[model samples]
Target: MIRFDRVTFTYDGCARPALRDVELTVDEGELCLVAGRTGVGKSTLLGAVNGLVPHFTGGHLQGEVSVDGLATHTLPPQELAHVVGRVGQDPLSGFVTDTVEEELAYTMEQLAIEPKVMRKRVEETLDLLGIADLRHRALRTLSGGQQQRVAIGSVLTAHPRVLVLDEPTSALDPTAAEEVLAAVTRLVHDLGTTVLVAEHRMERVLQYADRLVHVGDDGRVREGSPAALMRDCDVAPPVVRLGRLAGWDPLPLSVRDARRAARALRDRLGDAAPDEPPATGGEAALTARRVRVTYGDTVAVRDVDVVLESGHVTALMGRNGSGKSSLLWALQGSGSRRSGTVSVQGRDPGDVPARVARGLVGLVPQTASDLLYLERVEQECAQADAESGAAPGTCRGLLDALAPGVPADRHPRDLSEGQQLALVLAVQLTSAPGVVLLDEPTRGLDYHAKEAFALLVRRLAAEGRAVVVATHDVEFVARAADRVTVMAEGEVVADGATADIVVSSPAFAPQVAKVLAPGRWLTVEQVDRALAGAAAGEPA
Candidate 1:
């Protein structure tokens, strides 16, 4: 349905080609996953499919690209809109209509699709995407994840044969990402529609992809079955790490396979150790008791209670608008708390003055640039350090820690979204607060950056700091977080160790858990390793 023939594309005035001599194809109904490091032209490749490259983006294009038999370069965006539907990484930028229902039907109406047909399509899409309840809600009032679902629903309603989504779930939480991916899978499976998705959170979509296309930094492309590519390439799911150790052929793509592999390995290791009690720890670094935050008559957070201790990575898990952000803000005193008691280092967060509260808590807001207004990153951190009374050199060290190998003199706004996020995190960490709150820190990052961020988080936790992350990436939570808390409808629904929470709670678990039951590890590599170990001592 889609093909790129020896395509080489470069931005206008840029010396290097974003994509070079790339040849690829997506068969009818094929679900292809496109992945690479950030700025590797993954988004550029998607643009080539729907005439956005040479036409909209004003780039130099060479070689032929076709979609469903029509040459993309020959057609304008309007001409290709019927055959291809594109969803971008930023949810806020894609919205065209004010309300959810209206957004879903706008594309169909523009195409002169019959009113009756548009209504039926809108209803069906709302149900399929599980947003029937949001029909009357304004797009601006919805959570980031809800807006994303609405964006995708709007595109799918156009009835495009091919769907091109660029980091569609990057802004969403785990449950929301799963919701969108599940909808995409159903479209391909039930309707036989083709899907081309570019996402950094590989663990969520890798197992579902019929094929994996890895775009290299050198402008090369590798295409094959997901399992084959994961086993052979430098880039693979986290479970592949365990697969490499277990000696599984074609490495397990889903969790169930990893479980089988784990069982065999564990048997070989001779398990059956006696159970032991969890060790005791010191006082919690931060504690919230029956917390409640309200905006006028609406209660954003309700009767929530949780404790974050020093030396632990606690993942604040939940769907969008489930009170994660409100709780974080209230605890930091940046946002109001109607009724609740939050303590940071034995001091009441509610009683503290707003300016003083900031010195006690470091927060990385969902929007990466929220707290930043400086020209250069180095100057930003240095200024923060001076205000916080930390050594200037210490602040630079923290900046380097967050965005290693990147120049400090560069403007934060000039960097990629992921880099900008890292700079924000670096700025937050430099304040030397006892507790840290990261809201969707992994958004817009590639897999490599995700892994690196996880390692950095672990390091922070090891330093006896209390770290709390409000995020949607389950695999990330599994890898870096020591514990997990699941939220729904502004309440704390579940809380426990990351492994326990995912294995025991369906809502907080990744889609991989549905395939690989029992002890649910977040990453493909972790599952692979556990499987290999479990395979031990089992008869061949």
Candidate 2:
């Protein structure tokens, strides 16, 4: 149903082609997953399938690309809208209407379908994606995950045969991610709709993929079965790594298979679970008492009291609308706090100048690129230095440490989502604030980038800086966060050490923990250490 013949695409001034000599095919009703690290042109490849690459993005193209017997070169995106449905990384970017229902139906209206048919499709899609409750809500009011589902439903309503999704589950909680993936599975199996997805979170979608299309860092493509591609890939799920570490003959992609395969390994390391990461040890770096925030009639955050200690990393986790983002904003003193007192280093951040407040407490929002407006990375770093009154290379140094090898001359907008996040984080860290709050910091990051980011978070905590991250990545929280704080419906429902919180909550447990249940092993690294010590005949 989809074919790419020697396709090569290059941007206006880029030295190398974004995608070079790509040749692949996706049969009908197949779910082909595009796997690669950030900045590896996975998005560019997806755009080519729907004719958005050279047409909408204004890039140079070579060779042929066709979907459903329609050549994208001849049929522009508008002409191919009936056959292709594309959902981007940011759902809000493609929104054309105010409410979910309207957005879902607008595409059919543009395609000039019958009103009755459009309405029927809209209703079916709402139910299909389990988003009927959000039909009346304005797009802006919905949480990030809700917006993602609505974005997907809006495209699905068109009833296109080919669905192209980029980072569909990046911002979603575990439950929401499962729902979206299940819906996609139904589309592929029940409806014969073909899906071409590009995602960095392999653990969420790998099991659903029928085939794997890997784009390497050198602009090359390799297509194979999921197991064959994943065994040696630089980026892999924790289960795959666990298999490799345990010397399993074949890696297990899902938790069920991993658990079944882990019986023998479990007996070898009998009940020797490692201790959880140490808690923060310094004095309280920030404190919030009776914090409350409201939007019109909606109470987003309600009387939440919290303390963040220096030299610790706290992960704020919950459902999409659980007020994680709002609480973080209010604590940073950037957003409105209806009735609360937030003290950073014995003073309220809102009392200081905006420039001074940033130095006291820095924030990297969910959309990390919003903090960047400069033309180049160098300009952004220079501006950060000026704003923070730090050394000239302070921010650049932080960027290199967090994500190495980002070109200073490149535009911040031109960077990949992961690189943009790293740049924003670097800009925030230059201020040398006592506390750092990052919302969804690892959104588009691959395994390697996430590892680098986790190390950076640990380094900051060790340097006596309080760190807080609001994210949905359970693996990330297990690896990086010292403490876990779970919120629900505008209140702090659970707060404790990471292991205690994640292990008890089924929704938040990482893959390793799920495999080794009734035990406290949270990560593959912990298991590996235990085994190594056991091999050396030492008590684990």
Candidate 3:
């Protein structure tokens, strides 16, 4: 259904090709997962399917890319709209309408489909992706995850033969991610749709993928079965990593397969478990009393009271539209707070100037790119250093640590989603604030990038800075967080130690924790350490 014949694409200013000599084919009704490291041309490859590469993006193309035997170079995106539907990383950028229902129907209206058929497909898509409640909500009022589902629904309503999704589940919570993936699988299985998805969170989609197209650092692409490629794939889910760690044959791609293979390994380290770290017991870095945020008649946060310690990492988790972003914005003191008091270091950040608030609490919002306005990466870094009164190269240093090797001269807009996120995080961290808040920081980051970011979060806490990350990446929370706070319907539902909060919930548990059930393991690293200690005859 889709074919890339010796396709090589290079952006206007880049010295090297983003994708070079990529020959690949996707059979009809196949779910092909495109996997790679951050900024390694995964999006570039996906954009080529519908003529967005050389045509719209102004890049040089060497060979041909075709969908349904029609060359993309000959047919523009508008002409290919009937056969190919594309959803980008940032969903809000593609939205044209004001409400969820209108956005979903806009595509069909453009395609000039029958009104009755369009209405039927719109309703089916709303139910398929589980967004029936959001049909009447304003696009701007919805949460990031909700907007993402709407974006996908808008495309799915068109009923294109080939669906190309870029990080389709990046903004979704665990259950929402499952629902979206299940819907995509159904499209491939029941409806014979050809789907190509490029995602950073492979744990959610790897099990359902029929083929894996891995884009390596050298701009080359390799295609194979999930199990065949996972054996040596650098970017992999925790389940695959765990299978490699245990030397399991045909590395398990799902939690069930890993759990079935883990019985003997579980016996080897009998009664051995990870040691729980003691609480930080540090002074309160920030205190919020009676915080409330509302939008018209909708209350986003309702009289929430919480304390952030001086040296700790807190993971704020919830489903889509659960007020995680609203609460984070309120705590940062920049966003709207209908009624509340936020105290940071004995001062109310809400009453202070924006500059003062930065020193008190720095925030990397859900749309991290909104914070970046400079032309080049180095310029942004330099400006961040000057604005925060930090030493030279401080922001750039942080960027290198978070996501290394980003070109200094590249435009911030030109950088990949993960790189853009890292740049914004670096800009925020340069202020050296006592408290840091990151909303969906790992949205575009791969497994290695997430590990590096988790380390950075730990380093920030170690430096006596309190950090709160609002995210749906359970694997990241399992590795990075000391405390977990789960919110639902604009209220705090559960808050406790990381192990206590995540392990008990099926929707939020990490892959390792699910595989080694009856054992309170939260990450593959913990299991690795416990097994090594047991091998050394050390105390449990």
Candidate 4:
């Protein structure tokens, strides 16, 4: 259904081609996964599926990209819309209508579909996505997960031959991701609709993928079965890593496969307590009492009391629209708080000046790029230094420490999603606030980038800083969080040590925990460390 022949695309003014001589093909109804390091050519390749690369993005393309029998080189995106339904990283950016129901019908309306057919498809999609209840809700008021579901529904209503999705499940909780993926799989299986997806959360999508497409930093592409590619792929889910560690004959892609092969390894651990996060010390840097955030009649956060201490990383996990973001925003003092008393370093952030508030607590929003506005990376860093009254190179130094080799002169918009996130985080750290809050810091990060971020978070905690992250990436929360706080319907449902919380709950647990069930394993790193310690303890 989709084909790329000797395709090479270079964005305007870039020395290196974003995609170099890429050759790939997807048969009808196949679900292909595109995986790579952050800033690699994954997104670039996805854009080429529906002619968005050269047509919309102003890039130079060499060679042919054909969907079905039509050459994408000659066809613009609108012409390909009937054959290729493309959804981008930020669905909200493309939304034209205000409500969920209208948004789903917008694409069909643009395509000039008959009103009767459009109405039937919209309702069917609402049922398919299990979002029938949210049909009347405003899009602006929906949670990240709800917006994502609505976006997928909007495209599915088109009933296009091939579906192109970029990070479709990044904003979802485990249950919601499952629902969305199931819906997509139904399309692929029942309707023979082809899907080409680009996602950083490999664990969530690996099992459902019919084939794997790995896009390297060099812009090369490798395609194969999931089992074959994951055997040696640099970026893999926790289950694949666990299989490698246990010396399984065939590396497992799913938790069920790993668990079936893990009896011996589980016996080796022999009921040993799983590794725990480093102990937290120092007084509370922030405290909240009866925090309640409401929008109209909807209570996003309700009567929640929480404490964040220095030298600890707290992860906030919940379903989409579960009040995680609202709680964090309220605690940071910038978002709406219907009734709450939040004290960061003994001062209310709402009462303090913007400059003073920033010095007390720094927040990196979900779209980290929203924090950057300057033309160049260096300019953004310099402005951050000036605003925070730090040395001229202070922010630049921090950026280098976090993400090395970023082009100083490159526009913030030009950098890849992960690189932009690193830049935003550096800007937030300029003031060296006592507490730092991040919303989905690992959304677009590859495994290697997440490893670096995990290290950075640990170092921040070691330096006696308080960090709270609201995220949907469970694997990341397993590795980086000292504690986990689970939210639901705008309330604090559960909060405790990471192992006690994540391992006990199936929905929020990581791949390692699911595979090594009956054990409190939270991460592959912890299992690796335990195995290494056991091996080292043998007398020579």
What's the best-to-worst order under lDDT? Answer: 3, 2, 4, 1
Error of 3 at 350 (Å): 0.6
User: On residues 150-259, what C-alpha lDDT tens digit does candidate 2 reach at each position?
Assistant: 88888788788999999999988998888778888988999999999999989999988999999988778999899898889878999999999998877888898899
Candidate 1 differs from the real structure by a C-alpha RMSD in angstroms, to one decimal, of 4.2
Candidates' C-alpha lDDT: 0.78, 0.89, 0.90, 0.87
| Count of clashing residue pairs in every prediction | 26, 0, 0, 0
Candidate that scores best on lDDT: 3
Give the distance in Å from residue 277's predicted Cα in candidate 3 to where it truly belongs. Answer: 2.6
lDDT of 1 at 86: 92
Q: Which is the winner by TM-score between candidate 1 and candidate 4? A: 4
For candidate 2, the per-residue lDDT at 412 reads: 93
Rank candidates by TM-score, best first: 2, 3, 4, 1
Best-performing candidate as measured by TM-score: 2
Better candidate by TM-score, 1 or 3 = 3
Which of candidates 3 and 4 reaches a greater TM-score? 3
Local distance difference test, candidate 2: 0.89
